[model samples]
Target: MWHIYQFPLCPFSRKVRLLMAEKGIAYELQSARPWEGEDRFFAMNPAGCTPVIKDPDRNIVLSDSRAICEYFEETVDRNPQISGTAQQRAEIRRLVAMFDENFFRDVSGPLLHERMKKRLVLRQSPDAKALREAMKLAHDYLDYVDWLIDNRPWLAGSTMSLADLTAAAQISVADYLGGIDWTTHEQARAWYLVMKSRPSFQPLLSERMEVIQPPSHYAEVDA
Candidate 1:
């Protein structure tokens, strides 16, 4: 059995979920919120990050989200291939790393830590400066995305890969939080619209937060 410890809102967790769905893999989903400080979770992963996977057969515990995705790509042979050629695989890894490092820090981090922090923690006020900075960073990131999509059909290359999934997960969360302005980035927005319509993407669209509601357009796959 494959068991995944994850937080629903985490982009990293979302990427694994998407990959699982795309591969038609049936895994057990265990909600493990690192923010709540679970001892066993920390023992499994010292970093206490979400999206930790335990494979019973291998008796292996996978901590990092990217590592888990790569593990799946290598170990599983079902569905559309995510890691294509050597060059394609390298590009996917590069793009995934880029999204995880630069995009997450610049776009998703501040938006979640600032604008949505108050929602998650009552009595806290939104950080206007952080939100402004995140918005600027998101815009800058979109420019890079524009360049990517303009050149290639997908973020890494012609074929859809984990790179697209990683980027989509981040953008989807930002969209849920109303941190993205679609009109400003038409190319990226159009690419996202197509991704949001996929069967693997539906679960994420239907995700509802107890304390926060997504914009109407969020659930609209065509949007």
Candidate 2:
């Protein structure tokens, strides 16, 4: 069986988990906290990140959400997340990059680092300045998401792709931290409602950390 080492609220981990669930692939979920920098985990992934998968059957170990998702996209054909023509696939990749890199750097990454990881895992005081900067940047990021879904059916194009999964993963984590203002971004909220309603996303919504409780509306897509 495939085994994926992940943190319950990690966006990168959620991305891979959502993609696997969407494809109807079954795997064992091995929880890990990369921040501890354990020796065993380091042997698996020197970079010390969650969302690393070990495929015993295939004799392969994979790290990095993008690389893992692309590997699955190529090997598993049951449900293609990157489906479409060449140009459409390119667009999907572009948006996925935006969420995983740009949006992450400017918004979710800092927020999660300050509000969630610092308090819960690192046992350090939250950085107020970083949190404030993240909150402000998140507004602009959500506005862009709102604009993207204004016309298109999905973030990248007509169909759901890695872009949507990546986006929802990041946004869901932020929402869990009470960082999102859903009422202010109507289109983005609508899009997220659909994403949240999917069976693939149900598990993520149900996840709760012992150290931190999510907001009341965290699991409510309708809210």
Candidate 3:
């Protein structure tokens, strides 16, 4: 059996979980809090990150979402998320990087730090200024998604890929944090609704992170 060490709301972990579910890979969740700095967790992964996957039978221990995803991509022949021609694969990676790095930096990371980390981990009040900044940047990111939806079926190109999973993971977290405002983003909202309606997304929507809760619309597929 494969076991994944991850937190409920970690977007990168969510990305891996989505990919695993979409690809029909079986894995059990082993909840972890990297921020807590547990000795066992650090011993398993020196970097101390969530989304670590271990296969005891195979003696395989993998950390880092990208590395884990790519490992499965190479090992599994079916349900290729990074499929198609060389150019198409490149496009997928490009968009994946854009969401994983830029979007996280500008939106999801800040919201997580303010709304989740501050409240749960730090036991401190969220800074209104930082919260406002994250929400404002979320609009910008969603605006870009709206434009992308206008141009392509998915973020990268025609078929669903890692790009979709990555963006959906980030957006789901941001939306959960109430950092997203989909009121004016019709196209983006429609795109995300499709994502939310997927079978792989259902578990994520239903799961909670301790005391904090998402907005009512967060789990509603039609919303």
Candidate 4:
């Protein structure tokens, strides 16, 4: 069986989960908190990150979300290939990086760490100034997304790819924190609604962290 170590709220973990589901790959999910530095998990990945997948069938383990996804693209042959031609795939990679790196660093990391992580792990109050800045960044990023998807069928191009999954992963967490105001961006909201309604995304929408309740509209596709 494929074993996946993950954190429920982690975007990287969510990205892997969505990809696996999209590919119809079955795996057992094990929740892990890398921040606490668990010994066995650290052994699997010294970098100490969630979303590590151990494919017992192949007798190999992998770390890093992008590496794992790329490995899947290279090894797994399935319908609706996630990666396209070399040049198209490069654009997809670029957009994925935009979300995973730029969006995460500027918006998801700061806002989530302040609003969710600090309260859950550190047992401290959120830094209001940090949250304000993160929220500002989030709005700017949302406007960019609106423009990017204004014409294309997906974030990267005509087909749905890792770029869409990456952005969705981050947006899911933001929605959980009641951070996204979807009404402001009509095209982005339309795109997100389609994403949210997918079977792969349903389980993620239903996940509720202990002591933290998502907004009423979180799992509602039409909302």
Candidate 5:
């Protein structure tokens, strides 16, 4: 069985888990915190990142969320998340990068540092100003999502793709940290509800991080 080294709240790991579940790939979770700087995890991934997958039976090791997902997309061949015409695939990849890099940089990363890392590791209270700034950026990102939903059935195109999963992954983390306000973004909220109700998303919603708790609406699919 493939063993995934990840913590409960790592969005990148969550994205990989979602793809694996959608593709019916079986995996066992081995909770890891890269911030602790464990030598074993670093050996698997010199970058000291979570979401490293290893198959001891085959002695295969892989790291990096996008690379791991693409590896499965190529090897598993059951559910194709990056499928479509070449142009369509390009669009999907573009959106994935936007969510994974840009969205994380502006929204998810800040919330994680202020809300999660600060409270859990640094023993420091969250910065109200930083949290407010991140939440405001979230609104802008959600407005963009609203526009996308108004144009296409899904983020990238007519059907669901990695773009949708990638965006949802970041949003899920942000939401868990109480950084998301669904008010005034009806289209985006509706689309996110659909994502939350998916089978692959249920497990993620139910899992909890160490001490921090999500807002009440975080796990409620209809809320």
Candidate 6:
């Protein structure tokens, strides 16, 4: 069996998990918290990141989530067209990059590091300045998503792709922490509702932190 080294809450890890579930691939989940500095974790991934995949053959040690997703797409039998044709693949890559870069940097990263600090049980107090900055950045990011959803059902295009999963994973974390104000971005909110309703998304919605409870409508598909 393939062994997936992951933390339940990490967005990147969540993306890989979602893909695995979508493809109906059975794998063993090895819980590893990179923040704790495990030697084995470091051995698997020098960067000490979560979501590393260890193939049973021990020949392939995949680190990056995108690379792992691509690997699975190429090697697996079901739904092997995650990237589609060369042109479509390029677009998927671009949107996946956007989610990892722009969305994570300007939205989820700050929300977790700032607004959700209290819930995450950090040693430091919530930084008001950082919270304000993150809120502004998140709102702007949502505005862009709003525009995208207005034009297309998915972030990259019509069909559900890795791009949607990547963005959904990050946004789901924020939503879990109650960091989003969905009322402000109706289009984005609607799109998210659809994604959140998927069976693949159920695991994320049910995920609970020690101190954090998801919003009341989190488990509601039509909410």
TM-score of each: 0.92, 0.95, 0.97, 0.95, 0.98, 0.90
Per TM-score, the best of the predicted structures is 5
lDDT of 4 by residue, 1-223 (tens): 7899987789998998898899888889888988888899999998998889997878899999999998887777774436678899889999889999998998888867887789889999998888778777888888988998887889989988888899999988887877777768888888888999999998899888788888899999988
For model 3, how does the per-residue alpha-carbon lDDT over 33-138 read when each residue is reduced to its tens digit?
A: 9999999999889989888899999998899888888888898877888989999999988888888899999999999999999998899999999999999988
Residues 169-204 of candidate 2 have per-residue lDDT tens digits of 998888887778776888998899999999999998
Error of 4 at 127 (Å): 1.2
Which number leads on lDDT? 5
Model 6: per-residue Cα lDDT over 1-223, one tens digit each:
7898876668898898888888888788788877778898899899888799988686778998988998889888786537557787788788788878787787677766664455454666777786667667777768888998888878877788887888888888767656677778999888888888888888777866566567897677887
Candidate 2, superposed: residue stretches over 4 Å from native: none
lDDT of each: 0.83, 0.88, 0.91, 0.86, 0.94, 0.79
- Among residues 3 or more apart in sequence or in different chains, the pairs in candidate 4 whose N, CA or C atoms overlap within 3 Å are none
Error of 3 at 125 (Å): 0.4
The residue pairs found clashing in candidate 5 are none
TM match of model 1 to true structure: 0.92
Candidate 1 per-residue lDDT, tens place, 129-163, comes to: 88878777888878888889999998988878888
| Tens-digit per-residue lDDT, 1-223, candidate 5 | 9999998889899999999999999999998989999888899999888799999899999999999988999998887899999999999999999999999999999999999999888999999999999999999999999999999999999999999999999999999999999999999999999999999999999999987899999999988
Error of 4 at 93 (Å): 0.1
